[model samples]
Target: MTEAEYIKEAKKGSSAAQKWLFDELSGRMLMVCRRYVRNEQDAEELMLDGFCKFYSSLSGLQYQGSAALFSWVKRIMINECLMFLRKKHTFVIVSEHVAETLALQEDILDNLSAAEIFNLVIQLPAGYRTVFNLYVIEGMNHGEIAALLGISEGTSKSQLSKAKSLLQKMLLQQNIEYGKRKTQQ
Candidate 1:
C-alpha cells in the first residue's frame, strides 16, 4: 500500500498498517535513538515509545512526505533519548568551552571507520553528546539548540565546543588503542 494509504488505515486503527510502519522504520529510528542513548536496550525502548506516539498521532499529524515523516519520527526519538538522559544524568553546566575545536587530519578520519567515530561520540558525556549531535549531525543552530534544551545560546555554543574537545580526546584515545591492537595482531 502507498504511504498515504497506510497512514489512512493506521488512523483507522488498522493493526497491519501499524505493523508495517514498525517493521520498516524501527531500524532507522533505533539508530537515531542509539546515537543519543549510549545503550542498545534503552534505545530500543525509546524507539518503541516513539513509534507508539507516532501511531497514535497519525490522525492529526500532517504528512509532508516520507522524508518529513522520517524527520518527525526522528524528532520523537530524540525527545525520548533526551528524556532518558535527563533522568539518568545530572545536568552539568560546563561554563567554559574548553574543548577546543580542532581540525583533525583528514588522514586520521580516513583511517577510522564510521563505527569508531560513533563509538567515540558515545563515549562523551551526555550534555556534550547531545549538543554535538544537535549542532553537527542534526544541523541545528545554537539558537535552536538553546530553545530546545532551555539554555542560553552561549551555553549551547559552550556545550558544543566542549563536545568537540571531548570528541578529539576520544578520537586520539581510539587511535592509540587501535595502534596497540594492530601491533598485537
Candidate 2:
C-alpha cells in the first residue's frame, strides 16, 4: 500500500496499517533517538514513545508526502529525546569563556566515516551533544535551539563550539592511535 493509504488506514485505527508503519519507520526513528540519548534502552523507549504520540495524533496530521511524514515523525522523536534530557536535568551549561578557549580543527572531521563521526558525537557531554545535534545535524539556528532548550543563544553557540572542538580532538587522538598501531604491526 502507498504511504498515504497506510496513513489513512492507521488513522482510522487499522492495526495492520499501524504495524506496517511501525515496521517501516522504527529503525530510522530509533537511530534519531540514539543520536540524542546515549543509553540503548532509553533510546528504544523514547522511539516507542514518539511512535505512540504520532499514532495518537495521526488524525490531526495532514498527509502531505512521504518526506513530510518522515519529517513529522522525526520531529516527534527529537522532542521525546529532548523531554527526556530535560527531565534528567542533563544540560550542563559551561561558561562561554571556557568553551571559547577550545579551538576546533575543521579538517579532522573530513577524515572520519559517518559512523565514526556519529560515535564521536554521542560521546560528547549531554549539553554539547544536544546543541551539536540541533545546530549541525538538524540544521537549527542558535536562537531556535535556545528557545527549545530554554537556554541563551550564546550558550547554544558555546555548546556547539565546544562540541566541535572536542570532536576534533577525539578524531586527532584516534588518528594518532591508529598510526601507532599501524607502526607496531
Candidate 3:
C-alpha cells in the first residue's frame, strides 16, 4: 500500500494500520529517542510517547506528500524526545568554538562501530552529549537547539564541539587499550 493509504488507515484508528505504522517507523524514531535519552528504558518510553503523539496528530495531518507527512511526524517525535529530556532537566549549555574543534575530529569517528560510538556518546558530559546529539545527529541548527534548551546559540555550538572532542579522545583511548591488549597477547 502507498504511504498515504497507510497514514489514512492509521488516522481512522485501525489497529492493524497502527501496528504497521509503528513497526515501519519505530526504528528511526527510536534512534531519535536514544539521542536525547541516556537510559534504554527511558528511550523506550520516549519512543512510545513519540508514537502516541504521532497517532494523535494524524487526524490533523495535512499531507502535501508522503515525504512531508513522514517528515512532520519525525519532527514531532524529535520534539517529544527533547521535551521529555527537558522535563528531566538534562539540557546542556556550551560554547561554539568548542563545537568547531569537535567537528574537525569527525574523521576519528569513521573507525568506530555504532555500538562503540554510542558508548562514547554515553561517556560524554551531559551538556556536550545533548548538544552533539541535537546538532550532529538530529541536524538541528544552533538557533533551534539553543531555543529548545533555553541556552544561547554559542553555547549549543560549543557543547557540540566539546562533545566531539570528548568522543575522539575516548575513541583514541579505546584504540590504545586494544593495542595494549594485542601486544600483551
Candidate 4:
C-alpha cells in the first residue's frame, strides 16, 4: 500500500494499518532506543511508548513524505529513550572530562558491522551514550542536546568527548588498534 493510504488509515485509527506500521517500524525504532538505553526490555518498552505516542498523535501530524514519517517516529523514539533515562535517574551522572584526544582507527570501523559499532556505543555510560547518540548519530547540535537533557551545552560537549574517548579505548581493548594505512610509494 502507498504511504498516503497507510497514513489515511492510521489517522482514522484503523487497527490494521497501525499494526502494520508497528510491525514494519518497531525493529528499527527499537534499535534506535537501544542506542541510549542499555537493557533490552527497557529499550523495547521505550519503542512501544514511541509507537503509542506516534499513533495517538497521528491525527494531528502532517505527513510530508515517507522519510518524514520515519524521522518523526525516530524523534519520538529518541524522546522515549530520554524519558527512560530520566526516570532511572541515569542522566544525572556528572559528565567526565577526558583531556586526552581519541585517535580512533578509521578502517577499523570500516571492518566492523553496524551491530558492532552499535555494541561499542552501548558500552558507554548512560550520560555519555545519550549525548553521543544525540549529538553524533542524531546530528543534533550541542545546544539541542543540552535542551533535551536539561544540561548546559558544555556538559553535552564534555559528554560527547568522554563518550568518544571511552569508545576509542573500548575499540583498542577489543584489539581494534588505531592505524591509518600508509599508501605505498
Winner by TM-score: 2
Clashing pairs in 2: none
TM-score-sorted candidate list, best first: 2, 4, 1, 3
Cα lDDT computed for each candidate against the true fold:
0.81, 0.92, 0.76, 0.83
Each model's backbone clash number: 0, 0, 5, 0
Q: How accurate is candidate 3 locally (lDDT)?
A: 0.76
lDDT of 2 by residue, 1-185 (tens): 79999999999999999999999999989889999999999999999999999999999999999999999999999999999999999999987887764667656667778788789999999999999999988999999999999999989988998898888788778889999999999
Q: For model 4, where is the 10-residue window of minimal lDDT?
A: 176-185
Winner of 1 and 3 under TM-score: 1
Model 3: per-residue Cα lDDT over 1-185, one tens digit each: 87778888988998888898888888877766676677778888888987888888889987688677667767887777778767877665544543557444546667667777777777777778788777776688999988988888878777777777777777778879999999999
Residue 142 CA error for candidate 4 (Å)?
Answer: 0.8
lDDT of each residue in 22-114, candidate 4, tens digit only: 888898998998888989998998898899999999998887987899999999998888887888888744544543456455576668888
Best by lDDT: 2
**Model 4: lDDT of residue 176:** 35
lDDT of 2 at 86: 100
Worst 10 residues of 1 by lDDT: 97-106
lDDT assessment of candidate 1 = 0.81
